[model samples]
Target: MDALPTDPEPTDTRPTDAAPTDAVLDRAAGAVIGSAAGDALGAGYEFGPPLPDDARVGMVGGGTFAWAPGEWTDDTSMAVAVLRALAAGEPLDDDRTLDGVVDAWCGWAVDAKDVGNQTRAVLGGLAPRTAAAARRSARAFHDTYRRSGGNGSLMRTGPVALAYLGDGREGDLARAARAVSDLTHAEDDAGDACVLWSLAVRHAIRTGVADVRVGLPWLPATRRDPWAARIADAEVSRPRDFDRNGWVVEALQAAWSAITHGTTLVDVLERAVRGGRDTDTVAAIAGALVGARDGASAVPAAWRDVLHGWPGLDAAALTDLAARAVRR
Candidate 1:
């Protein structure tokens, strides 16, 4: 294979340094664009194993959703919803902030392709209600699907890091992450996974290294021991060791496993999608972490140039949203 290029792609008007360090903007844009690139790359082969070495892995679309080549799936769409909510100029943990997110989610879900079962159930049922009422409805919905633990929440969590990080407040970041997850997913694991991944993205964007273990201490005592052990084990494991079937625990494990084992953005994304089932979400999750670590410039120009998604966002638009998100 050819070596991955290092030039930054044409996405978003690069954020000015007056707001933050150039590294911050680069990683912020990378987090959003990287997720979309990974989603589009993996979309063509959703629910399937890695292609043969000779087969092209570039975005060709036509998976279960039959998307156009270069188009991202619901993962990027939902994340953008969260980003839009944060861009509304309210505190991340405010009731109005959560309401904005809930509204954006329901609006997106109205015709969203490939919506997750858990998310669809909560949003479809509670979208018309007030945020307080929706939270209650989401809890009841959670009771019915507590054991399933889908990766729906985790897939869109990258934006939370951008919104809440750099404030010198990990607590606010955790609260925002949990709040975002609880909107549609009631399970503790689902919420925990979002916090863990969002914090990892925060650490990577702020520090230029993707370390899944950084957020382990923030987990509740009940989950800390098990999640810590699993993350430690995943760091040395191969991608196939994880069950990439959309469960949040396994999804987190799969993403962290690939990230720890791979040496570069290309290496991480390739290993992520090769696990087969839930390819796009797994790769998108991993992409957010590694992209935050490496910056948007690390994504290949071929993929970046064509990256697009629902709600009419291409790489540039998503980066613009991401830039605005980090500033808020």
Candidate 2:
């Protein structure tokens, strides 16, 4: 464990047409970098049990896959695919752009250190490799096996929020989140979690407040009440209680539970990593939310200095890419 600030406060500002202030830029960049940081931190503990409260946690690496220290796993790699697509002026709303994302994913998956089971099955067998085709494969995989409610989609969802920020289009944000998630996770639960998380990240980027409930209205009516209750439960429960941390619903619950109980960015991420199974994914999810609220400057300097992953990105490179994404 590391030092955590006490209740870091969020800036009170919204996205504007003018060049973003440093605080906004930091938060935007933080959302991506913080995610990678947590992913790398938890990578070493991928399938392990919860650590004792006082146990040390760092970017040790070498888990289910022997990831290098401070090297992010599939979680950040996939998010980078999305970020690269957006940074290149590709809007995820367009089929062409989504297909570009899938192509990036397939290209990366070939050499990636690890790939989620649900995502691998869909991407490996994709015929056309088109976004539409990927969706079809995802649905088929889900239908035949009834196993698409995994956390793969949610783990890479944070950056989708960056695409529509300051555009004043919450509707587009929700749509893009759902569509992007559907490419691999055709389940309704998967899409719903993405919508909620994307909007939640957008809200944090804009107003500096972290509230997953912000996207509840964007979900179908029947889901609203149930998700609301889930979110409420997360706030009051402990992260370890949601033992099935691989499922989308429980994943969100575990992450939110950690975020709700922790005060600073480091604290939230620590709580998430200590939640046991699927450590990296849960920590990555919580990291994005906390980073949006706290900004990049709030991340521990030690962690940021060493943070890195696929596509040859280190901390500053990731920050510049996020800047491009926000400015674009």
Candidate 2, residue 304: lDDT:
85
Which residue pairs in candidate 1 have backbone atoms (N, alpha carbon, C) closer than 3 angstroms, thus clashing? none
Q: Estimate the Cα RMSD of every predicted model relative to the unseen true structure.
A: 8.0, 6.5
Those runs of model 2 whose alpha carbons end farther than 4 Å from true positions after fitting are 1-15
Candidate 1 structure quality by residue, lDDT tens digits, 173-286: 777888878777777888888878888888888778787766766677667788898788787776666765588988889888888878888888888877778889988998
Give the TM-scores of the predictions, in the order they appear: 0.90, 0.94
Error of 1 at 227 (Å): 0.5
- Candidate 2 lDDT tens digits, 101-124: 898899899988799988999999
Candidate 1 overall Cα lDDT vs. reference? 0.78
Q: After superposition, how far is residue 217 of candidate 1 from its true place, in Å?
A: 1.6
Clashes of each: 0, 0
